[model samples]
Target chain A: MTYLIEGRDGPWELVVGLEVHAQVISQSKLFSGASASYGGEPNTHVSLVDAGFPGMLPVINRECVAQAVRTGLGLKARVNLESRFDRKNYFYADLPTGYQISQFTHPIIGEGAIEIELADGSTRMIGITRLHLEQDAGKSMHDQDPARSFIDLNRAGVALMEIVSEPDIRTPEEAGAYLRKLRMILRYLGTCDGNMEEGSMRADVNVSVRKAGEPFRTRCEIKNVNSIRYVMQAIEVEAVRQVEIWEGGGSVDQETRLFDPARSETRSLRSKEDAHDYRYFPDPDLLPLVIEEAWVQDLAAHLPELPDAKCQRFQDEYGIPRYDAGVLVAEQATADFYETVARGRDPRLAANWVIGDFFAALNRTGRTIQDSPISADALGGMLDLITDGTINGKIAKDVFEEMLESGESAAEIVERKGLRQVTDTGAIDAAVQAVLDKNPDKLAEYRSGKDKLFGFFVGQVMKAMAGKGNPALVNEALKKVL
Target chain B: MSLDPATVRRIARLARIGIDESDLPALQRELNGILGWIEQLNEVDIDNVEPMVGTGHAALRMREDVVTDGDAREAVLSNAPDTAGPYYTVPKVVE
Candidate 1:
């Protein structure tokens, strides 16, 4: 399905590109040896190099470089053996150095693509233009004081990988899907945490609009959108704004804008005259970064199975459907948990239980897979009870609920509640006969071609047996009786 | 390779260096002289020479990712013109 904006002249198409800045996961800053952890005391993580004191030089962090390489490999990008750092000069309160040390002319990674799956199960390959390494500026808090803004340099000098995408996204949903898939890949690679709420990952969105079969129009960049949902919303409102301008006999001026999520609109951040002249030149303080081919191969060899491969393997190995595999492999911990539960039990049953009641329980109680109330072994144990005829499916739900509340194993809950399934044929027959005796009219109707009444008799038998009767046995006994 | 008055003023503005309008002619002449000197390199007939990045042929040396510095907040903020509590403060810049 095509996503188009209904303009007065014709349908207008949207073109979107995203530049995502992901903070590299390392113990120290990219240049200085200061701690790069989030939420430190103000100015506590600032080093002389980070503070930009005169005559202080920067040395690269080996782990940070390896992390960038790991991320580049994860994206299936070409790792440039030789890359240089350049100084992008600008003035801002949060930036201690007048220029940001970024890769301008030669980026580290180039020409990669990520596959984004939309809501309709259709996938599209979004082209990655490049990924470069740069230093993050400190944060400024304007509301902290009446006359001044507070600056925190803890995040300054931290390494960030700016992943730029080609303008291939046609819809707002594709933008969201692209961000989600990129975050998933980053998290899977352990190069970045991909936490938007904590400011670990941020995006700059580029949006433009054009009539069908027309050339690309001027694109306005929306800067520093912190959340994935807001990215999607910004693209939508910005594209609509551009379409209206073009339809109103006006041209959209290219500029940097900010997404005001509260108003659900985008406003220009700077005018054309105030446009950025970054004056990029090679930094004299740092040398060119060169890596060996062997190092790249080593990093690529040790990467964990990525999400797509893991999702495919889950379907092939467990015989689960693609949808179930997708849900299970969204997170590494969840995939591991599913594998644990499906190790020896019936995999389809395991997937159904995990995706159904178990996930619902987690959501209802507000717990993650890492801190799930019931362990994988415990869930597997509950499935074991059902498979062995020790408990029926309905009884398992009760046991599951009890286990969630008390943090007990399924077997313990079953034993304490005495909710084992009554699998004996005689006992099931007696319960079925009692239910039929009590409901002769329904039975007469069932005999008179009202086959739907059979379900009511089964429900009555299970209720009489306290939801402990084996479901298959109840159905068989009901058929035998009537 | 020569600097015009407007280009000179723009450069000065971009660099945040305040200059008088009267200094444009002299500044433009000095900048053009410097550019003219650097432009002599274009006269050479070296078409296929690879660009030299740095003085040495060595790759950049990297440090271990360990926190060996920091924790002296007072020293870090010592040179700031103004500070509020433990933070460095500047005139409120919202954008």
Candidate 2:
């Protein structure tokens, strides 16, 4: 079903596309030899070229270019061999140069698609328009002074991959899923860190709403939405704003706007500036970028397994359900941890424990897969105890809790706590007899066809054995005694 | 395209260049003259020609990614016209 906002006229569908600026993972700036690392002293990363000193020139960084190609390949996009850098002329205090060097006419990557799986288990492909390389501007700290602002040139000229998407999204959930999938692919490729909080990845959302089956309308660009949650909220509020305007006999203006998450409203930043305003011209200081076809092939050959392929393989190899595989492969670290625990073990049981108890523990402790108290080897050790019948499933949960608390192996916790499974038939039969003696009235009612009391008898028997009896053996002994 | 005096003023304002109102006519004339020269290039009828973006060699020269040119804060701020502590201060920006 399509998401729609009801207006005076009728239902209006939202059309959203995102342009994500991902900082390329490179050691140096795009054209200058300055440091590109985040959070350094304000002016410590500056160089003559980045600061736009007189007679300074730009030299392209090979690693940044390689990273762009790597990202393009990861997105399943077509990479153009020859791409040009153009000067986007603008004036700002943070822009030391009067222009920004970016790809305008010939972008590096062409059309691609990303498959996004929604919460309802339905999937859709969002088209990627293009991916181009550009330089980032410096920061203007207005809060640093009461009467004056301060300039921080730390991020000047850092390489950025601007991934533009086609306006194919009809719902906010689809938009969120697209951003998440794109971020995952970028992280998997190691081309970007995808840290929105650190400003490593940010999105400019283009949103419009129209009556169903109508042509595209004037879309407003929501600038610098740093989080997926904010992007979804911005789309909702902006689409509703457009619907109201259209229904109230007004036209939605084409312009740039800012999403104030605190207020949950989008305010116009600037009226529409056409492409001619930028006056983009080819940069004279640098030549056209060209890469070898063989080099692209080589990079593709060495690419790591992506999330989609890993998810499918997990299902096929581990015999787990699609949902379980998806949960496991959402993050590379989680997938690696799961694989280590599932190797040569009962995969279904491992999946259940990891997805159920392990995930809950991580959430409760505010820990990530990297810092989980239980290691993969330790979890696998606990699973081995269950597989070898040393401990029943009920006792295994207790041992797991003990392992989490004491940072000890599952076997050591079981031994220290004496929680091993009582697999001896004689012991299980004795526990069953004791339960029957204590609950004679209920046992008689159960024997007279009170089938619902069967579960109660099992619980009583297990309690009498201190939850150490193997459940399967206790069930068998109870049937024999009855 | 011919630009009027008002358009010239708007362009100058967008560029953050403070220009006197009296200079608008002259600025408009100068900009139109430059645009006229660029318009002359449209006379060519080479429909099959590929647009050229670079001269000499078409391939860009790439350098290895390294951080060998930073931590010279004194030298970097030496050329600034105004400074406060480690930052370059400017007139307050409201936005």
Candidate 3:
């Protein structure tokens, strides 16, 4: 569906692009041997190279580079065998170095695409322009003091992969979906942790509004939106503001803006005149990064199965619906859990149980799959009792609840509670006959064209048998008597 | 390839250098002379030549991902003009 904003002139289309700064997961910083862990004592992770001591030079960390390569491969982007780092000169208290070493003219990864599925079950391919490596500045905490901002250098010189996207997102939902899919891919690749709350991943959103079939207008960039929801909301309010400006006969100016999430509006950070002029030039301290084809191939070969491929395989191999497969593969741990339960068993049944009750139980208890009270093996064992006619479905549910509460296996719970299914025809006939004798009026009504009363008979028969009677056998006995 | 006065002022402002109005003329002359000397490369006919990046032909060297340094907060912040606890302090630059 086309997303349009009805304007006084006509309908306006919102154009969006995102630049995501994903902190690379590694043991050390990009250039120094400082620990790259998230939280620490202030300035404890700062090395001389990170702190910009005079005559100190930066040496690249091999694992950071490999992490970037793995991420590029995950995105299906082109890995530039030879890439150079340039110094972007600026002055900031957070940046001890006067210049930040970043990939400017030549990025390490080029042109890739991510496929995002919308709520309507429709998919769109968002184009990725480039992915570059850069150093993150130290964090400045302005709330710590009345007159000065305290700087923590723990995050300084951390490796960040700035993934830039093309202006192909037409709606706010697409932006959210694109971010979610990108985060999922990064998490699967083990390149970035994708923890927005921890400040590991951040996005700068560019939004523009133009009438349909018209050329692009001046775009405003919203910097450092921490959450996906905020990114969507910022794009929406910014686009509406732009449309009002255009319709009111005022031209929009290109600038950088900050998203005030509390106010749900974007305010200008700087205008075009005061725009940053980062004097970029090649860094003399480091040589060009060059990798071999063999190394790239090895990384590609060892990559874990990505979400899309795993989703497709789940559908094909397990005979589950596409929606179920998509839900299962949203998280790697959940997908692994589903696979363990589905193996050598009724896959569709396993999927139904996992997607239905197991997920609901986890949500109710506020637990993740990693710490789920019921293991995959235990759930599969419960399914085994149902498949082998050891217990009826109704009894299985009670057993499942008991297993969850008491942490007992399904078979043990069933044997101890005497909740096994009564598959014997003799017992089922006796129960059905007793229900019929007690409900003679209802049976007469059921025989007299009240076909819906048949359900009532089945209910009563199962109730008489304490809900352990096999449903199919009860229905069979009830039909034979009628 | 020449440096105009306005361009010089803009460059100085971007570099956060305070330049005097009286010094603009001489600074422009010196900057233009430097650019003029480097502009000789534009006269050479080398259309297909690849830009040389660094002096050495060797690729960039990388070290293993190990926490071999850091944890000396005092040493790291020794040269700071102002300090707060273990943090380096500067005038509030909230954005």
Chain B TM-score of all predictions, in order? 0.84, 0.89, 0.85
Predicted structure with the largest lDDT when compared to the true one: 3
**Which tens-of-lDDT digit does each residue in A269-337 have in candidate 2?**
865653238889889898889999999999999999999999999999999999999999888999999
Lowest summed lDDT over 10 consecutive residues: which window, candidate 3 chain A?
Answer: A270-279
- Give the DockQ-based CAPRI class for model 3: high
The CA lDDT at A389 in model 3 is 96
TM-score of chain A of 2: 0.98
- What's the DockQ for every one of the candidates? 0.82, 0.76, 0.81
Question: What's the TM-score of every candidate structure?
Answer: 0.98, 0.97, 0.97
Model 3, range A269-310, lDDT digits (tens) per residue? Answer: 974655868889999998999889899899999999999999
- Full-model lDDT, candidate 2: 0.92
Model 3: lDDT of residue B22: 100
The top-ranked prediction according to DockQ is 1
Model 3 alpha-carbon drift over 4 Å, by segment: none
* Candidate 1 docking classification: high
Per DockQ, what order, best first? 1, 3, 2
Worst 10 residues of 1 chain A by lDDT: A270-279
